[model samples]
Structures are given as C-alpha cells and as structure tokens.
Target: MDGDEQLLRGRVYGHDHDDPDPGPKAGRTYAELVGGPLDGLLLDIHGWRTEEVDDGVALTTELSRWPGGRALYDPRPGEPRAAGPGIACRFYYSGDTP
Candidate 1:
C-alpha cells in the first residue's frame, strides 16, 4: 500500500469487541454523514472498492435484506468537533453459523 492508501486505511475502524471506544465516532444521524441534501449522496468503502448511497434509511433497509450482513458507522478524523464527524458505512457479513 502506498502512503495515501495507508492513510485511508488508517481511517477504517474494524470491529472491536474489547475496546469500548473505537477511534472513530459512531454515526447516529443521516445529516451527520451527508451535509445538506440527501440527493446524489455517495459512500465509499475504503479497500473494498465499493460505494453506495450515504442514506441512513436506505442503508438500514438494504442491510435487512442481506442474509447475514449488518452495517456500521465509522467517523472520519480531523474535522470540526462541534459540527459532528463525517461517517463511512462499514458492512460485515458473517456466514450462516447459527
């Protein structure tokens, strides 16, 4: 991985059960991710080379359609603390093991 890729990789916060507070802030609101209008919103999942709409409602609905997949919110760093952090959705798929 190159320097830029490494920096972007550093932004991704993988699932951590032990640590209560992962480095990135959890996105709880749609407005937090997309600034103003929801139209033409795009989400990019680093390393995975995938992008989707940055809509909370749409994402939640889509997540439920997946058999064993779920979505998570990971905030970006070095933004205005008060304005709330920008979020990137991370989806995880665990094969049927129930």
Candidate 2:
C-alpha cells in the first residue's frame, strides 16, 4: 500500500500556466501533488458534469495522456468517494485535470 501511495507523489514534466515564461519544468500535478503516481490519478469532479470540453469520453480519453498506467477516476458528486480514511474533508477536481 505504501508503494501504491508512493505512486501518487511523482514529479511530471508539463507546462505551468502561472509562469509567464514557464520553461520545461517537472512539477507535481494535482494528483501527483497530492502524492499520486504518473498514471495513478484520481479524477473526481464535483458533478462529473457533461460538457463539450470534458465529456465522459473526453475525460476517459484523457487517461491516454499517461505515460503507461491506469488512473483511478471517481467523478461522483461534490464529495469524492474517499477523501481520506477517518478524515472529514472534500475535494473537487476542476479544469486542473492535467
């Protein structure tokens, strides 16, 4: 389980929007920032709403972006399946899926 947990804490190489002149920098993604693996992602939307940009198909297809691994997606209501054991907290993954 610890190894699986480790999967969530990997640094990835991607573009950072906040940086005006953001060069190539490997930073931890939302999932990775929370300690998720490259593909060990968990996309949990507040409503998993349907949209032209992020439809279920598009969301599922996004998984392909992963190098080579599976993502644990949970698009439930406002609350994720399990934010954390014995923890009373909630998280919503918005346009920050990448």
Candidate 3:
C-alpha cells in the first residue's frame, strides 16, 4: 500500500456492512485523525469507500469541523488495483485550503 493508503488503514469505520464493528452508534464520528498524532500523514478517504450517504456525510462533517483539516476530492479515474473505486478523496492536516 502507498503512504496515503497506509495512513487510512483501519481508521475508517461505521459504514462497511462486512466489518464486524461498524462504528459509533451516535455522536461524533471517528473518521478525523488528521490533526491528531498522525499530523504529517495523508489519509485517503477513498480507500474507505462507502456507498452510503450517511457515511459520506459523517466524514465530510467531521473534516469540516476540524480547523486545520483538509479534504481533496479527485474525480479522475484511479488505479485498477487501488482499494477504492476509480476516484479519490484525500484528507490531511493543512491550515490552508487547496
């Protein structure tokens, strides 16, 4: 796995029906790990791919809540071997919005 993929591993939850533990039953989500100890790392939200709107909403909302958090949405096609679909969304710690 790449750097982005590795950072996001096991950090995404609450959306996968296949996962034994989905996520929190209520309150804030555990998706935003950007400004925490993993500050310099880049996380690929796409790798956590969720078709459910609720999951997406939760992620977006959490990212928005963090002042230093940044999210980049890439609509281009991704590698076939990638964990996610042919699209990318990256989340990281950046005070500046790109």
Evaluated with TM-score, which candidate comes out highest?
3
Q: List the residue pairs that clash in candidate 1.
A: none
The TM-scores of all predictions, comma-separated, are: 0.21, 0.21, 0.23
lDDT of 3 by residue, 1-98 (tens): 88544543443432554667443322222333434233332223443434431232222323343644434322223412233232134333333332
Cα displacement (Å) at residue 44, model 3: 10
Candidate with top lDDT is 3
Over 4 Å off, model 1: 1-31, 34-61, 64-68, 83-98
Candidate 1 residues 15-72, lDDT tens each?
2435554333344211222322222233333233222322222233232335343333
Error of 3 at 14 (Å): 1.9
Ranking by TM-score: 3, 2, 1
User: Which residue pairs clash in candidate 3?
Assistant: 14-22
Per-residue C-alpha lDDT of model 2 across residues 15-42, encoded as one tens digit per residue: 3335464322223123222223323332
**CA displacement after TM-score superposition, residue 95 of candidate 2 (Å):** 19
